[model samples]
Target: MRSRSWVRTVALGAVLLGAAAGQAQEGKMSQGVKAREQIEERYRWRLEDLYPTQEAWEADFKAVETDLQALGKCQGRLGKSAKGLGGCLDLQFSLTKRFYRLSTYAQQLNDQDGAAVQGQELNDRAGKLGTRLAAETAWVEPELLAVPARKMAALRKARALGPYGHFLDNILRRRAHVLGKDEERVVARAGDMANLPYTAYNVLSTLNLPFPEFTTRAGEKVRLNQAQYTRLRTSPDRDERRRVFQAFFAALRSFRESYAGLISGAVSRDHFYTQVRGYRGDLESALDATNVPTAIYTNMLEQVRAGRPLLWRYLRLRTQLLGLDKLTYSDLYPSIVPSVEMPIPFDQARGTILEALAALGPEVKAILEEAFASRWIDVYPNAGKRSGAYMSGSGYDVHPYILLNYVDSFDAMSTAAHELGHAVHSYLANKAQPFHYSGYPTFTAEVASTANENLLRLFLTARETDPKRRLFLLGEYLESWRTTVFRQALFAEFELKIHELAAAGKPLTADLLDATYLELLKEYYGVAEGVVEIDPLYAIEWAYIPHFYYNFYMFQYTTSFIASVAIAERIFSGDAAARDGYLAMLRAGGSLYPVELLKLGGVDMTTAAPYQVAFKSLEKTLAEVEQLAAKK
Candidate 1:
């Protein structure tokens, strides 16, 4: 993955490997996790792929610093000639390649053990170096845009600039928003202040605010961190899950005022940027960054809202299978059927994921095998290691690296499949496109990953002959759509509403937020139709989602999942053209805009057809699950 802008990273944690959203740290680890040194060498990633030694890393670090001066030499010369522009771009890519390699090494090292001071120092230095590189290359874009249109057209025709035509076109497309140097400098200065709200929220949630631990009804006492709260939600014990939910929300409620204030400030920051960029509103501003149209956003919300019947049906299915008189928000987590916990060992997961993704064809299968054999993955949890899973493809010149705390569950296996999708996508992109086009945008980023996840689920469902386990697997598949599409679309609606409210001069207080969220929850969950009940206290659930700080990011998960369903269905049905088209997409990377690329890959988000396909898939699974539930 290319480096995310720091402000967005601060908001979203920059999980670039594009695994399924809402992943939890679940499953059994023997005793507690181990220290990094205790893990066997084969299980850990070989950072040597990047640099053989710390000394080599330091050498490259200095080399990048030295090369920074050469970029400055191209600053005023970009518009002089096509060759001048091409030279500056080539130099920028060269310097950026080296800089990212150094940064990736330090970042992986630091993530391995965040408590280590030396690792922290190295990561910090890499961050500062990136800022320096940004400063040095800041003139290139504005200068290129300043060039006369006819001159840019002539430059585009130059053989030297052939590979960068799309790149230059993107800059020209944003010419209206690209400010003059002095004004750009002023906006850039304000960029430094934009992270304050997010920083404050991080500090409050992750560090300062106190969340007391709660003991489950089964006598296991658990601390109420974000991961623990997630793991406890699916507890077999209904009372236990309720205790977990109440306790977790109670903590969030206690800090309601503080959270309300912080989130309000974050919304204001978004509004500020939207206005400065001359966008009509926050949604337009946020979507414009990815060159997505406002229609795609509106269309997603509209489709999901219109698909409420499917959601209500799924909710009713859950109630019937769980043997509850009525469903409540607290009852939503337990598996619809008695879940067959498939404890897939690490080696088994590796093999299973390889087989599951074989539908993408032999080339993808080969890439997955390499990912396993080449030590491209760091595959277990250790003391002070980062929580959750992600793929760091920042090593553009090298193979992608994946970080996994692989707990032995079916979900863990699915995570493996999802992240390997990202890894292989990066592998193909980096191999097929130049360095500049190698990194894909977030709009299409989750397509390959989520498609892999769907493929894995379909593979598992096909093989499970036992009726009960098949039902469980089917429910698992439906639950994925519930969370990824239906639920995230709901989140997208809430985010849009809140942003609109703030932009319209409505003060966002805890009460207002809670009421708005509660109303939406009831509407989507069909509380009025008696599909589920929303407890008033659960209205504060929005306060718990860290992704709200991510500024209109949750919708892509829905859009991408919808597109992937269409793509995966075609490939799984043995369509040769679809398979080739999907492969072409993975290889295209950022060479095309996300919407265009998805269209080429057989799913077009601009229309409602793909969303209808997704809903049909959900409806089909729900019908099967409903029939299976009758047998129970």
Candidate 2:
């Protein structure tokens, strides 16, 4: 109903989540997953910065409810005059800023401990409040659309309304799609139904679904939750990895119909917007929100599909390095260089990451230091903690927070740098821009986070003398490219196919979904060429990923990964202009469209230039991986 400045406040919370420890109380970090109470206070996030006490959070939440009535009073007044419009917007943003804080606090609290009833209740309360906010503010866009263009343009130029030009223009960009006030209200009310799929999905997947337990090679039994699945999939023991895949996917297979129903409903929700809004397709409708060209989406698909040869090359090399006759799906996650072990303690990893990111300049480095020291991160896996890591920057006034299940591995260190990139971006943008322009979209946001990851890898690569370690680093980078770039592209293709199928009036049955996914998996992994064998059971892997419910959100990972590779290469090469331009992009924030923001960061994602550079970088580093392996 409105820009994600407020609507998506909870988004930055748990996207790709990671951690380590120092204090006398932090020794538990080296152990297996513990309860949230077991984590040292120094390692936990200071959400109190947003609200020092529960009473304070309640005060703000109550204030928002009271202010929502006041905001509604100005509802019909938006089209009255410039002063009225600006004043109305002022109240709205203020309420949203406060709501964002409430939502973030509740979300992180629940995520840190899903079993806590109080945290779950707080999160549900925040959700209801968000729905109310959307329903009330839904009229703002339709009313603005009703305003005459001549007067609207003049209002945009008005000194009081100057800051709202971007926000207002974004609404006008979808002018044809904006419906009558009543129609807009209906769509706004449907927010709950639109949210049902993801909501039901999270409940079932996170809280309810019975994740199968497995015993490791050492006879240690473990419950394979999503986070554990990710961490264990990379096991060096082939038999163990196969069993992990079998047990985890078999659990989803039992609920295949339910997952299919949920995901199919997700696609149907997108289709509803497409048909109602007169969009070319769901892709058009989704991308149109951020002013991205559909060609950008299609172009990425074309480029990455054509670049499958590089993936095959890496796979062939991987097979040789692993001494396997041929690669299978399970073999993909283990280290190609088993001789190298990259583990750094949490405190030591902190220094290594800071050193890697120093090219970002002292100003950012200072903020990075503050982020670490100020407990801006929740840094260990505990009972009920959400899997994956993400950086939430929606707390415009309180600074950014990172959710990580740090396992004290090198990959976890890279994840810390990646999410910190997002934190720094939020810190810079929130500091530089106003409330309306502070929240950025995922497209450019991913670039910022990934850029930090690239810088870390490059910084490590340039310093390492051991060929095995260099190969390990190179292998990690290549794996990032595979997963973030090519693998996400394959996902994009599957997403589009499912959406198209749903639009064509076909049911997304579990059998159909499995067949479709397996087809793409086979093609993307070069299954037909005998490079890798894809098991049908792994097709349910889609059910494991949370992003499918995100509505065309996965493609940006590919696009951003490409952009960050180039951005990091330029900055690490000591290009002052490139470094400045890249940092400037983060500060620019949601003030610009996603693509234009990339241009500011010195990469044109619309063209093939960024793709070329990224592929070349991958190719170059991959060659070194081969040479290093050869040396062994």
Candidate 3:
């Protein structure tokens, strides 16, 4: 039931359109009026939010092209001295800023249809130019590695390149894995081709797949693709939800062999890169790139396993609330308490999110206001709009841009809050840290956003007056635990098994993959007493998830949920010190390792405490839901 990548593409385009087209309803305005209007007038988003005019963007783009070409002059000189290395880094940072501005403008322009033709051409050119610029300066890493460790250490102290010390240290740490100039050049040139398999799969899935049409419960015909699947999963009628799932899985089942090839190519790609880099294993290689320990990844899986009993307990509660003899995979998406539909308007949702986040202090609130007032948000869904939501942040020089599909529903509102949490995290980090440390790792990135969701859930639960509404809110919280934590853990486990099979030199055919996934599904769902049927075809479910292409990435969702729950609890418990500590973690960015950064937020991911706390919270919510059902 999770949102697909293509939806994100649509949602992103919609955000761009919303910014350019303003708030006119579909068919209400003329094409010329929509096209000619600046991003701010027709939509809630301010395209002018980043740049006042297309002419201004051209000027910035030209400036960046000139500066990027100048970076070639700094090659081979980085190892001369600490000052030289610092100068090169400073220039790189400047070039990066210009590139970010140009790229953001081009993307915004392309998002709007009026700007689509020229905008897309410009974007492609800028991308190619940026890659060329990056290739020119790729020699810096090799040159830095050539410098003796002792000499580099001395330079760090003598030259007082304080902000860049961590940056240099990271490069030195990877010196053993760093390739020679010729090898590095070969790898850099292979970048575009290296991603061919993933690119091919994306094109086929997004553009070529012939999604089937299905009849909804309302008797309306709908084409069942990724986006329609999202809509169908949330259908009020259970039969409609079931039909959609069956049809969708059937489509995937039919293409099992093709999907297997795509998945195999992705897994092989990971193994290839890891071996080339001399990593002991693929998981280690993936985690090492972000400086996150492998223990954290394994710990997440262990914790989720330990909490299986709690998941089973919740499943029983779900069966009871839905008045079903058995709970199947199809039953999972519908609300156990069907009466609780809390539709919050976009404006009211904004107010609610701000009120919930009040514990983060006034300064945090100001940034949220800026998001609204400065037109940083592109709100609403339109034809050809990208699906789903995301927060895109570059650095301090360029503010964050948020993309959303607001349908005046609580779920959409929740998405807005989630992405804004990312924006706020980026804003604080960029403001507090230097350019070198402005971005955080993906492992830590989800913590801020998930924590915001937790806080918002708590605030809404506390304020609800009606019993049904309270149950509905509680159901939403429980659903988050089920999906983000339990379901992702299921994914992580399946991925681990697949990789182990590959590591053992076993071939992963379609049949083998199906068997492996079905077995995991049975274990996770606890299908004793003939309660639920584990469909054999559902094994192809693995083929649909794009995150599997990202090595060892799914485990972060489970770990992040655990970390966020603990932090949100502390902040809501009136602990001002805890709130400050959490804020500090957001500001630390990539200045420290993910585990170390999390420690400052009072959650020691190295320990079992966070996982235990998150499971306990799940148990408590289930208990409350059960009690409410008993009264009913």
Candidate 4:
């Protein structure tokens, strides 16, 4: 994957260009042409929602600094008495809430205008404040660990401290591994520097490196950057797709040593942190930090491996439908049933999404409608707008913001539905839970979003009566499974092997990484049907994925898709019981572990039932596509 530095550099470049455009437009305001509204005016996100003014933000910033300083006073008192501990907890929570508000405002401002000097300043200031806060609160856990388990249980039962029972218990449960104050400070300080490797990689990938040019079908040359690369990847023409793959990776390969250094640095950083914190391995350490079981990660890989035959079968179907003698990696993208492009405008997309979600009833639909009606979304791609899409929700004190470089297309429409699922999840959690528990863990986060996408897919499939369009919808469904489940699982497998190798004191040089990745690509795509040819250069392809920086995070995409398919199936089958259970799961938030929460929603990740069911859906869709293609 590109280093974080490279990502930031790319982000900074986009911001700079965006700022220049904004300034130029401001200068031309006097011309007869209408002036574009400031970002604030164009959107309903209302930065005021986070902080009414710059002055208010500054006031809170100073207040948090002062409050954080006072937290030091409670350092040794956590074990003193129930009252002392309770007081300390209250202070910590209050300080966190205040800091969150300030940080949210700063971050939202920066995200909206990455090039703005003031926004950048606020972001940096908030980051520094956060580091100071972490240092001050570093003592809380260690101090809590000082208390005996029996005494902690007694304090938990005390009426005065009843409200914070969960908070106290959670901290105490991890007491065995909790480090001392000095150690914690060192770990905290190392974090800022630890991020440097990724930052460096990002800078090189996004700004420093020169992208190669590709010739389109029209003989027109296009310089391939991140945005254009994405478009080319999805091009309908197979040759165009092949050209993109070759050119893009060729550029990346030119800087092989630089990419290798960044990745090595990141691996080293992870190992350092693991050793300092007394972890068995980096993989274990990463999973432990997120409170997820290692078995969940391993189980996902095992299940995906077992399901490879089904994937092969699906690929064979695609080969037949596309009337190709042999399928290559490039063939996996373009539409198989291309009757019409069917580009849905943003407004229509919003309406379609709301209407599809009507199954969740009026209340759910109302919230979604509000998201569309409110200026919460920054729609359309303008010069310098960030590439891709994300739904960002800092906390309940602020509303969610959905950013899209939307180009009216079917895929873009599905992306809108997917992101809103995240927004709704945040909305529900924030509304129901306290600030402490408002955020769900990353494991369960993708469930709601994927479920929304599945629901929208079902809606679109049902509404389309034409055979070709219906086939298109089904083709999309099959592709989603392929991409989200199979593709991500492949990534998960590669990530695990690399980390394991690193932790075992083995070399993870670019050559070794590339070989391992290419092997997996061959295993996943090199089935008996000969649909896709997994290229050798694609091995180093793993270096470009950002998710590796996230540490075993991509697997959830596969797991969540399977889980969502199960839930969506139940809802579509008119199972009122299933629908209710799924809704309750959403509302349950972080109160339950992901596995348990998924069980409540009628899918058990511990078992292979969900995977089998989801794969069956893939098989069924492929069969339908084959039938349609045969008819023509």
TM-score of each: 0.90, 0.83, 0.87, 0.83
Clashing pairs in 1: 1-393
lDDT of candidate 1 over 466-557, digit per residue (tens): 99789878987777777877888888999999999998889999999999999999989998898998779989988877778777888887
> Better model by lDDT, 1 or 4?
1
Candidate with best TM-score: 1
Go through the candidates in order and give the clash count of each. Answer: 1, 8, 15, 18
Ranking by TM-score: 1, 3, 4, 2
lDDT of 4 by residue, 316-365 (tens): 77777777878887778766667667878877887898888887666678
Off by over 4 Å in 2: 1-69, 99-136, 185-264, 339-343, 372-392, 401-408, 502-515, 535-546
Displacement of residue 437 (Cα, Å) in model 4 is 1.0
Cα RMSD, each candidate: 4.1, 6.0, 4.8, 5.5
Report model 3's TM-score to 2 decimal places.
0.87
- lDDT, candidate 3, at 598: 96
Model 2: per-residue lDDT, tens digit, 146-170?
A: 9988878877887988888888878
Which sections of candidate 1 miss by over 4 Å? 1-13, 16-42, 53-55, 109-125, 148-151, 207-215, 219-228, 243-247, 254-257, 382-387
Q: Model 1 compared with the native: what TM-score?
A: 0.90
Q: Which ranges in model 4 have alpha carbons more than 4 Å from their true place?
A: 1-43, 46-70, 105-132, 148-150, 180-193, 207-213, 224-228, 235-237, 251-265, 370-389, 395-409, 503-505, 509-511
Candidate 3: worst 10 consecutive residues by lDDT? 20-29
